[model samples]
Target: MSRTMIAALVLVGLGLLTGCATSKDELMPTNGMTMQELWQQGSSMSAGDAGQQNIAATRATLRRPITSADMVEEQTRYTREAANEIHSQFSRLPNPDLVIYIYPHLAGRDQSVPVPGYSTVFPLYQKPHYAMPGETARPPGRTR
Candidate 1:
């Protein structure tokens, strides 16, 4: 190819590549005001008038006295929630386990009954004890 033609092709390719590589800011419409300023201008009076009307309506509704039924319902809901919290707080942890090994032995009236070697498993505590707040759990003791 001729030198001038090669140079023209390179320049056109570079221009095409640069034109395709555009930023998001360059795609947005240009306005004198920012987003916040535009929103303020559009909602200046309507927002204040609507907010004042809503506040007055809410205040008027809140000024009414509570009925006996409403009071009883609210009290019942509070009492139920309190009872549930107490029950959850006082819930117990699982009991610790105990494993025992029994050696072979003979029994019965004439001492002729032979028992095979076996093991028994049971819980260490009859009642469960839950740890209090801010208390760390204790590690189990090592067994021989």
Candidate 2:
């Protein structure tokens, strides 16, 4: 084997090895929480160690009685926070398209499902309205 050919092969081997040495799983959930749990924890997390606590509090709100006034206020607050978080996150994400699917279910059989099991193949998503005037609301990375 020629010296030039051997050196080229060695360089290619080193490049392949270096690429495989990098870990894609660098980010992991803290406090021993599963990745599934963390993914469903939503985006309104506190900027402190109280993130888990905030998740619990949010879940509690889901069970509260919804009076007219309460519903209005709660929906307003939730919409605002959710929008800000979505904008911030989507700005950094590669694709901004959100695909939502809602599954059909039998009537009056909501309790027959197993615990922590998802029965619906498609879920409903409520979209919030955002108003942008003139060219100020142009999307990123595109020319008008």
Candidate 3:
């Protein structure tokens, strides 16, 4: 390659290396302040004030007052979220009781003893207990 092209490539490589060498402090300007201090400085304005401003802006942008349609939509959304939570909880629980009935049939070719038809019943889990949300799951035969 030409001398000028080589020098240009070297400079570009140096620039890239320097860019990658940036420290966390350099990336985020905390102004030599502690995390709490930085947070306080950044959040000088009260959250209530910001919320009010957003509410005012929304009110200004809205052409009409909220109607029954909007209320119904929000109610439906809440209902769906509640139903989803119930479904998640139900799914986390163990399966229900199961029963199996075997039909009366002949025994082996030797025809030793006839196997009697019977019904067996057993729970999906020995201990049908459920864990609350955010709780760790316990294995069978283990108790918390």
Candidate 4:
């Protein structure tokens, strides 16, 4: 009971403190000067003309376009050899596709909906077979 009473008092005190903080609606004046004017006054006192010029130069540098020259790491990531390896590493083995042309037919349980003539494709194998690295039997056209 005492713990519950203490929690309730803490909550009430917090509520009163927040209410007091929000009660005043007027914005505090900075000696009749705008907020931007006050910030300019402070910045002028802390930094010299050279420091301000350096900031302007930094802003100009930030506006430049991003390119390969800006890259910090090695440039070997997107080379031709890397691209070829990516394509050849997990190549699927030869699997001939069988296409069957279906004539226009009405297909429905109750309503006879006419399906347009279309060709459906099915792989000769049951599932895709990826060639193992350094396998004895590689795909026909693969030079490696």
Which model scores highest in TM-score?
A: 1
lDDT per residue for candidate 3 within 1-144, as digits (tens), equals: 999999999999999999999998878876778989867866665457876798788888886778899999888755746656654443345557889998887789887768899999888888756557655354432322
**Model 3 off-target regions past 4 Å?**
31-144
Any idea how many clashes model 4 has?
0
Quantify all predictions' global Cα lDDT against the true fold.
0.73, 0.58, 0.72, 0.74
Query: Residues 1-144, candidate 4, lDDT per residue (tens digit)?
Result: 699999999999999997778532355535678889989988987589888889888998989877776563345544558656644665667788999999998889965898899999999999877777655246444633
Of the two candidates 3 and 4, the one with more favorable lDDT, higher being better, is 4
Q: Write the per-residue lDDT of candidate 1 for residues 1-144, one digit (tens) a residue.
A: 999999999999999999889975678865667888988877776569788898788998989899999999888755746555544444445577999999999989998999999999999898767656334254432111
**Candidate 4: stretches off by over 4 Å:** 1-80, 86-89, 124-128, 136-144
TM-score of 4: 0.30
> Could you tell me the lDDT of residue 14 within candidate 4?
97
**Clashing residue pairs found in predicted model 2:** 101-122, 101-123, 102-122, 103-122
A best-first ranking of the candidates according to their TM-score comes to: 1, 4, 3, 2
Candidate 4 global lDDT: 0.74
On lDDT, the stronger of 1 and 2 is 1
Total clashes for model 3: 0
Lowest lDDT sum, 10 consecutive residues, model 3, at: 135-144
lDDT of 3 at 97: 81
State the lDDT at 43 in candidate 3.
67
